[model samples]
Target chain A: MRGIRIGVCLLGLALALGAQDQANIVITGSRKYQMAVPDFNALPGVAPDVRATFDQVLWNDLYESAVVNLVGRSLYTAPAPQSEADLDSAGFRQAWSEPPLNVQRLVFGSMQVNNGGLVVDGYLYDVTQPPGGGRLLARRYADPATTAGARAIAHEFADDIIAALGFGPGIATSQIAFISNRTGHQEVWTMDYDGHNQRQRTNLHSIAYSPRISPDGTKLAFMSSVSGEPQIKLLSLLTNRLLPFPTYKGMAETPAWSPDGKKLAFAADMGGPNIEIYTINVNGTDLKRLTHSHGYDNFAPAWNPKPPPGSPGQIAFVSSRIGLPQIYIMNADGSDQQRLPLGGYAVSPSWSPNGLALAFAWVRTGGGEDSGASDIYLWYFGQQKYVQLTHNEERNDFPSWAPDGRHIVFESGAPYRTQLFTVAADGSVPEQLTSQGSNEMPNWSWH
Target chain B: MKQSTSRYFLTAVTAGSALLFSLGLAGCGHKAVPPPPVPAPAAKPTPAPTVTLSADPTSIESGSSSTLTWTSSNAVKVELNGAAVDLNGNQSVSPTQSTDYQVVATGADGQTANDSVRISVTQPPPPPPPPPAVQPAPSFAESVRDAFFDFDKSDIRPDAQQALDTDAAYLKSNPNVDVEVVGHCDARGSAEYNLALGHRRADAVKNYLVSQGVDASRITTESVGKEDPFCTETTSECYQQNRRGHFVRGQ
Candidate 1:
């Protein structure tokens, strides 16, 4: 790690922060601007404990994908999408369906307890009509390691969502990195999005938090108190060596990597009054400050929807500029501060892979670390509208959007331990994704 | 940064201990100080009676059951409970009905006794099967024993939240079992905390189960913590564990 910055002088800091101006370049494009509800029929998030509730986070994740649409199979009556009033007026005789079920694609699953573990059978269909209308597209099985499965199951659904959308099924088999306090010490953890095969990545005696996976899913950049200061460490998943942000000062908190996987953007005290945002190379060189909000703290960053061959370079982050926390979209550089006043004290702003939408935690009424009640919100760039995803009373925050952009992962301290979660972009499937530990600061990595 | 509080505490304790140790030596009667009348070397301490102890079962699973047994010669009393069991010897050999068993030992010289024998049972191993073929329909109970709040409250009361957790754990492990969690509440608070309680309780159960490996599809939660009364009987003691959540296996 080489090349660092000295934030000792404000004037000097101003000079260095100006260098980031070249990074903020935005582009206008229209492909798919809505959260895609991909079919998660095959995707399984830490499988639900219901021997049969039948609704899965995968379905919800797919719903968020806005790819494949979901019509609850268990809820599907033969003929109609009607209001409760409309349904009653139509009578039980009204074949339950006006909008065709499985019209775009059919995603169905069956769960059963087998030999002490949950055995799930999932199927995908390409339906043009109703009932037996679609041809079988693909199939998969999810046998929770035990009756209790986890985060990996969501990966299962994510896979099906992809397969259902005819994307040749990728990512259904990748891993996500998060933070968990399983060993009595908070450290970096990795588990399938469904919350399974949870393994600790860092075993230092100090508590580790805020794990953000690199674009290629080969590395993780997170904060660790191991060095006696909250410093940033880039960990190689393949190798066990730790790469601390070469000799930076103060605390480095939340972190995000560039789409190219060359640089890391993180928030740190950097010997200042407020925790601000900064970025550096993977080698810890060229330390660049992203913001200069003297007294206000700015953090929670996500690369703006970088797709493959054709991708726009943008960045979305949470900042408390107007006296209240909100989400802002900008160029990779620190310029063109466009605000999407989320209208609430928002934290953990996660940009979708496509950059069309953003997921965040917005505290509605009164509830913080003391009260435990908070909600998650989704901001759609296309609709220019914010949708509430979580209505539960538990405090939910730290959102991490899936590589696909339809799903968001976060952590909450409900009755259960403060752990990770994945919700549909619509916030419908507010499924808890961890067990037995205080898991927080989740960052999604690419497959 | 790694908050190695234990190490920090250890260092502090070590430094304090060193200072105290030195001060203790420094004050160790180095200067001539008159010694107080030493009690006539306490009457030749009577030889205490022999006490023998042995666990009825020496081992047990971390959470399983076990009993202890002990005998003391020339002792008047003894008792047993978990750890060293209890201190009194008045209780009976309540073996069949108790989970933790203990024994005490004592001596009757000026007269008292102490006794202890701790026996722990093993983790209920796939409960000695009904035979090898009938696999236990693995009961996964991912329930929340602590009551959680909604919006703005910080309290974890005990109640149905317990059973609700077991049900959740059970359901989480059995993905095939769809569960409809009906959240209930005792008559109390703004209808809000209760509903929120009910919903929170159910979500607590749902979240716990989901984390435990249960598929989300098999579980759904709702709250009625304050609205649904188990009995209009108007009693707080009876509504203790009932002031929370309930999980019903969904069809």
Candidate 2:
């Protein structure tokens, strides 16, 4: 009798382990986990427009996450659960987990207006769990009762859902800093990742461009002509004012922040013969020159988010030291410089979040009929091969990697009227994010 | 006495006869010594006067005057518009209405030659108002020229040298005026590298100006990369125009 009991116990343990493995497959497998998000219930006193905004933003956020395959609304057999009580209904689980709507997860919630503010009760359920469904997440988000407020709540809820599903962090809440001439000057502007809440952040009334947001998103370092010359200017986003920075002779441009947010690596001539790379502390001290080549131009420094073992970090920059502008990587202190073997002209190197690959603009054949068109290419450190992301398009340049490392934002169009666009890392689903005026130089937030 | 009378009568008769014969021959001989050939009264000796009337400007704007001139030859008197005037003269006339100016020249034989010119006049247009104030001098951009470069090159070209020379001359002439050199590039190539290339172009321009005896401190450099283009067309000429080192007056 004891042996039978032990055998049964072992069998039960083995079955449980197999089920857990299945769950693991659902979380981290090659195939995308399917999810369904029905409309969130709007309680009394909730404006229709606010509810609509919330629903649309939430759906778009999930769709653009590119992690889960959202089941179309047409396949939804049962209405969305209005509250937590609806999760106890077997029909809800059966309708979502059965064929024609075979989604493993469901995100349903309720929104209301409380004290002139928006309140959202969001929930995520694993519909594949037996006995109705297992609840994975429950949270309440509140903000001002406006469309923007609703959008913010939706973004937060979508990010929460993405995190609960085992995807690292969603980029729904991140912002993209870009240059826009909509205000008649190339001022620094920012927008949500899905192209909402576009707000101009500068009024220099002069030509200001090449905005690089600090890693913490608290400061912005950009090139501006407010002082009648192109100099690096820093602005505190939290204060909406200019921060004091020392001005150098000659032209300073393309300021990139280090990963730790303690230093800025930029290109400047500083009355020198050629433009070279330099690093300075965030407080505007400890100026160190990186490249020392004479008469050979170097600029456009991008720092790797993660450096290899036993190294402070690596910086990828563009240099004409070898005659044509090519992408080169070196230690943060500007030592051990090595050029990637990309034959044609390559510039604008943006390191991916993983620090294993670089996205840059490349002209595969230089100085011929094919030289005029440049495409974005990704070079992987592990593979040592380039994968072309854009093909035969207009002048595409200034590629910035998204925080998720799954998408890249870049500028493409005629030189005079370029606009910002984002595409999946695999060169899929290219979407234009800006259409007003000429927008360019999109720097995605580090977060 | 009878015999003497008879002889005297005969003599008288003879003498009378002789005298009569002599008278009749004298009359025939004197019949006509034609008045010394009067030369058929040589045809009148009068040449008709030739006159020409013209206006310096046949057409004139209203309120403007045209100079009417007349010239005549072989004319004893000349009349312009029924008023006697010299055979060759000019008069400034502001005609209120369209009028035909006639010049008649009278010759010595009462012969006349005439010429006429028409001057048309319309209502005068309103006068243009005076300029409000003194016009401003040419802007810095107009006074200073931009230096252009070839595709993907920052080295000073021959044409760029001429431009920089002129710019340097301007800078030297105006010591108080500081300037900024902005480098630009065509739409082709990467934007970041273009920024760097633009910087090189601007630095090259500054160095050239400094070498030409202009103070380096008076000049600063900036690169707009391919952001702000002077030319927006896709043609090679437009691209060339876009790739330039522009000059801006410093404050």
Candidate 3:
């Protein structure tokens, strides 16, 4: 489509303002990343520095999230040249081993001090359990002190791994948002989700975290520490300018925007022990309260947007009440609190836009090796059964429904990298999203 | 050892079955236990034992603890990945990485109960930032033209956003300047609808500038539905391009 721009019509803040106390605004940081997976276990036996470990963990987390599959290492070990005349063969094999494969493969690598501060060198391989083999993808490096040095090292290798395999790379192949401790404090950082293509979005050198993606993934809403208190700021991926959410009385952190793009709800300490849910217009006005438990702590209000049954407005939210935190359903006006049967405990509720059911993480009170492992489940109110999605011993939460509602994205980590995952509505076929730094708080937008 | 338990029960059941058959009963495999009789009516009663259950603190790292905590001391098995990790009294793991701690706390009677904590152990910090992404900017005129459209639609997409951001950057950098906004829509709809749609597109752009904190006095809007077409329409693209709000010179 030909580009269209809407001119600015500056109307002073709407006159019908809900007056409140003087806004003492406050804010935030991120352990962030994204990268392509040439090898799912590339960093496994590699050096264990903070960067390498971050790359590895980010990969594991993203893989476990089920957003994408980690094919193998970015670069694979190739047979060394027999002589100087074999350069052409070596290069050809390297290029051939870099893409997606008919036969799935994995590789591993490490980053360390070389020439200066750091350098990443790695390899990819072809392996599919029953039969295993190796092919060299590429040999890449990162100069010292570069933005996402480790991630960049990982990204190139991932790209090569993709090229060799014959298909596109996943999020490790795509970009991601996160928080990191560069410039001294935490700020929203970007790198290939697999830990490549790293850059800093918030140069406030202050602090920022809890990044929320816009419906189209062009903008990010995150909590910032630039003004001392955590303030929600909307940032443009294209422009790199920061738009702070209008100030509030206390702190405005952990923001979640609706699918329609008119409202943004955030966690604020309006006047309680824990954060409460508050919604505001994108222009930062018309603030409304969705919950008023008086004393009970409540945060994480996901806008369950199928528009309530029969009625025009209602939503499902997760709250801590009846002793333990559980899923509760209510009207948009904070009426009719019905507890959902999510077994022992359920938090981090993600509502599908089509509103067929709710997907949440709950503690599985059964035996096996997963005592601490959280299982993902779908609360099919229509079916009256809890369909379990993930059955592994990993920490999985923050389920974000894709615009299609067929796929649910979330964060998973065994400390690999805390990346994103996408699973079908029925809880089958999980794919990873990111592979590098920690990509957390993934809120998917409608296409 | 593996067969002993089953064989013992089988032998006992077989002997019992033989005795029952000899007594002229049909072949009997295993007999079910009878239900307990109703409790006797008594005022004086001993209280059921109070099981002092203590939560086992699984070895989770100091940071990255789940938002919840448990202190049960006499729990049965602690869950790590998912399956049970057998633990004695109070056991904990300092998982530097993300690990699930599923703690199965048992009551005084060996009937097991379960609780779990999903812990995410983050690794160390990463290196400095990567270079900024460098997407070639569309030419200045191409960008400005895309920012105009009907109301209530961000359907303008990326190309438009990019173009608007460019103009916005110029305006923001160049102070002491203002602009007039003119909105327009196609003639296919009623006058009111066209005007409304035009206003929405106009307002959308105007709001974008305002969010950038553009001066109110510097920017204003007027809508003209089929009122004026800067370009005669042949196709929808031309029609859409004409049905937009643009900024003229100002303060």
Best by DockQ: 2
Model 2 DockQ class: acceptable
**Where does candidate 3 stray beyond 4 Å?**
A1-186, A189-200, A204-209, A364-372, A415-417, A425-429, B1-251
TM-score of each candidate? Answer: 0.45, 0.73, 0.38
lDDT of 3 by residue, A1-447 (tens): 011111111111111111322111000001111223432222322344546544754465444333335444534344333322333442433433444332234344545565555555555444322222344454656655344455445545544554454433233334456665545555676554334345777787654556776766678888765774456889998888976568765455667767576778776654233446678888878888877664344555666666656763555665655544577777666677688866455666777656656777676442112223555666655545565666555556666665434456666654223556665553434556455555555555444
lDDT per residue (tens digit) for residues B1-251 in model 3: 21432453355456556665654532231234343463475563222211112223333444533333333434444443354444444444455666555545454456444545555565556667787789765543454544754322324556666766776776776665566666666433222223334544555677677776766556665445434566644345655666666776653
Cα lDDT tens digits, model 1, A325-423, are 567776666777688855545666777666666777776542233343566666656556665666555566767777655567766654325667665
For each candidate, report its DockQ versus the true two-chain complex: 0.01, 0.28, 0.00
TM-score for chain B of all predictions: 0.35, 0.46, 0.39
What is candidate 2's lDDT per residue for B80-195, written digit by digit as tens? 99999998999999987888898888989998877788888877777798878887756677779999998888889999899888888888878888998889988888666777
Summarize candidate 1's per-residue lDDT along B55-132 as a digit string, tens digits.
444565655434343555544555454334333222323233225343434445654333334443444447555657
Q: Is candidate 1 or candidate 3 better by TM-score?
A: 1
For candidate 1 chain B, the 10 contiguous residues with the lowest summed lDDT are B187-196
lDDT for each of the candidates? 0.54, 0.81, 0.52
The CAPRI classification for model 1 reads as incorrect
